[model samples]
Target: MHASSRHGTVAAAAPARGGRGGRDRRPKRADAPDWAKPPARGKQRDFKNEQRAAGGAEKTRQDTPRATTSRSERGVRASEVLRAVAPRTSAKAFEDVSRGTTVLFDDPREVTLEEQLHYEREGHVCIRRAVEGVEMIPMVKAVTGEIIARRLEAYRHRVSVLCPDARTTELKDVEECKRALKKHSQEDVGFLQTFNLHRNESSPAREYIMSKQFAKIAAELMGCERARIYQSCVFVKEPGMAETNWHSDLNMVPLDTNDFVTLWIPLRSLDEDDAALHFANRSHRDFALPYWRTIEGMSDLEGRYEIDTYDELDLGDLTAHHGWALHWSPPQPKDSVPRYALSVCYFADGARRLETEELRRTPHAEDEWSYETWLRDLQPGAVAKHFELPIVWP
Candidate 1:
């Protein structure tokens, strides 16, 4: 018999004599602690002393001057994380910007005649809040009629629907929209990005923007020595357009003075539920500081009483593109409802250069605009096949 058979026989017989069977006996372990009679398979932990020593070493390193770096160096190191996440803009161009001077206008030959007229007029200042609860000026009103007419024509062609109201095309996707963006790097770069749609310039709607009539009108309303398209973008909110996180436009356009204005024309008159725009008043003047405790939960004027309520605003927070400006609605909604709005930014002809170096040095640099794209896409001669409004500045 094999040794196993002999052992098994002995164990079976021993169990009959007493409980001294080999299978019933427990083995003694020398590798176990007093409290733990049975040793576990893994090695014991050395956590106590090692952790304390490591923590002490880290603290010592932080305290020692030899291991310390200057705040500027520390800041650069911290920003490395964001630099990785953000789309790369030309960092080299901005590096020596202190010594760098921007040509006030890139080229004079490209400046349109309408821009010249507006440039002269912007110097002659006029400020008025006209109409019932709406700011209006006679100078701006005359040009608005033409703008309304052009907008109406554009809407009919694009949507294949008619809006027979006093309001016309608030949103326009003109032919030269892409080319215009190439000129002014002010609008979308770095953290700011935009999308556009194609529209034929041969349409009557396209003819109006190219006629210099719109530029003349914009100059009068904006009260700028010249008014030019800083950026042109089209945004559509379908039945389920994603809501935008609360942010500011000023963050996109680095400016010295708050003399800039944006005209938001909606293609359709929008209702409350169909995603209207929300804005804060005069918040642009002092945006270096916080405006609201939180953007959400703010509904009525009383809710924003902590902040000055002198500046009335539309929509509290239901829509995206919430900013310091007073918000308004777009024309149409998806369920045969229209909610279209055109946002055009115009800056004064002459404004002081704001020193952006200090602002860029701030801890939160994520929201800054990038000039890299502007340098790449901007081309003077590249005219859009359809240009409703020329972007040239005198």
Candidate 2:
């Protein structure tokens, strides 16, 4: 889902291949699948034209009186609005958190029925002050320093830029690379991405990800007896970093269950304009919606869903979302400070591997890494219980 060009341009979907009425059979791009490759420059222009035409139709629909008045005419409550948009079982899980039914992770084992319902219904929940902002400062600084060092090394060596799992463009020289990095930092082209910090037991990020405090909450939210660490990454969104398109983590994962969760921990306070993550409330239940297999597809889905975002997210406040939830973030304001966030993904203890061709052909670099590093050796249909997937919850 993070597929993009070396310059960080979002890849557009290729036209359906084969013949009209036949199955799509677009040719795959070299080194990646069709879904991962940026559209040909010529195709991009055509796509934009198509989008503009469709936008006119969409505006007309929104202007219709029926569309503007439907929800208001029914006097729908906040909870009812969610129910109307979500599946029956999912809608029923919403609880009145303001009525003191919200459960903060004071005791992870003490997850209330209301808390569990909230997670099930909304596909996410926020824990205010889950960790002190001061506690994350050192970790953020350490990761940022590492990214710069790595970039410098790649530039000096005249080698390809190294991302978490793939090589990007080759740098001309130190100065050129610096200029490029600076330009990209301002254009939302690239961000500092480092993955699996928990591999180093001494890493501050590892300490946070493996901490019982976080794992217990993840386990409780997942409604699992225990949880395993699936992956961990530090995403440093430099001011003006590009928007992350809408997509579900589940589609990228090779697991066959909905018992996965991601903890998004911001290293600093963020106002709405600073590029906070947003969700399509209860959209996790809309599994039938096509997986955002391409950037174009994700953009299309964005036009179809109502996005929910927090206007002001404070430091230490953490968001936990189900793996299947649809979420995205806009580019940070150019004048804002850089955004550093740590994310840890967890899966229920008993999840099993999904043996499907689609999983095998997932075009994203991260998905490829997940398959090769975490699941390649496991037999299809077997429990996803590799040692790499360490159990963090009891």
Candidate 3:
């Protein structure tokens, strides 16, 4: 069930008032995200059936990755790699692309037959706490504002300080910067994304994105030996950012393979009303939509496919869906703090560019960043092996 189908959100101080947890979105720092603070001592909100199984404990049989049991001893848990990789400023993600110098364990891991079948039938699957090190995600909640401040500061430094242009606005602080970015990107209608933070090498996200843990999960789900990273993006949906219209990620990219998968990792516990992800079950199998529907606005495919989503995604829980699967999310009510999620896309190592006639004519100018950064100089049907795209698995 999606958020609208659920009756409650995270507990707050306003059960009696009955309006968005009765939150007052003012006084700057006082409006701390609830997930960052310890849960108040009181009656635990009736979560009904949803599980908060942290550190990979308390999982049902269906939720367990059957392939990881015996192999679990050999395969490195996600946390191990994160702790091993010290944050360094010089190295970028997958820096040792062909050289086999990565610190992570390189053993093959598999998904249970049931899980694979579920993904085949539904086009998406949720794996709870499989990426165990995501327990560190709560820290991301604290630094959400800092990320905004730092990024805008860098932008101001580049344009206003260095170039001395009248074009740039005198963005005062993080709040003003946030408003400017929201207006710049139509954050209510679209999304705010920062990609490849791992390129900085000093970012903690670098370990998570470059680690073989995510690559192995992608490979196992797609039944492939190798999964090459196409990109990693951290998506921020702030309070008051409206719901996003339904669209497919595959529609925006130039890749031409059915083996592509995107893993969505929540950096904190998500509330039912606050940006809960919704997917069109099995929508990828019948991909007749030939153009980028995002540019065209809300798609009308909801009538054709069933919407599937969890009421909530706890910290460490993640969802991996096929690139062609249609998905979107609801608005974050003004009561909530901004929610941050990391989405990493991986495809089979030998996947190539579009070869079909209709696909060849698709206008990809809107996504020129991806083209210049990784897809440049490639003809149709050529293997997508740009230096930026690295093979993260066997």
Maximum-TM-score candidate: 3
Q: Candidate 2's residue-wise lDDT over 1-394, tens digit each?
A: 2223211222132211000110121122123233222233432223235447887764563343211111112232222211122212211222312111111234433445665676688676666556554444555556555545555553422222222222334554557655554544222243555667676665544555676667777888987887888887766666555666455677667777879999887766554455566666567887566443322233344345444444445555677889988776656545556676778899887888765533422333334444455454455567776656778776
lDDT of 2 at 58: 45
**What lDDT score belongs to each candidate, Candidate 1 first?**
0.29, 0.54, 0.54
Clashing pairs in 3: none
Backbone clash total for model 2 is: 2
TM-score (C-alpha, index-matched) for candidate 2: 0.63
Model 1 lDDT per residue over 150-185, tens place: 443333332221112212244345433323333432
Candidates 2 and 3 compared by lDDT, better number: 3
Per-prediction tally of clashes: 22, 2, 0
**RMSD each, Å:** 31.1, 17.8, 15.0
Q: How well is each residue in 1-394 modelled by candidate 3, as lDDT tens digits? A: 2222122232221111111211221112222355543233232232222235332333342242211011112222222222232333332333435411233334423566766876788788776545343334533643354356456553433233223222446776556655554455322223455656655556655665676766777889988987788777777776666555555677656677788889987777664555667776667887454433222212334444556665555665578899888777756555566677878888888888664342522332223334445443455567776667777785
Candidate 3, RMSD to the unseen true structure: 15.0
lDDT score for residue 213 of model 2: 69
Q: lDDT score, residue 320, model 3?
A: 85
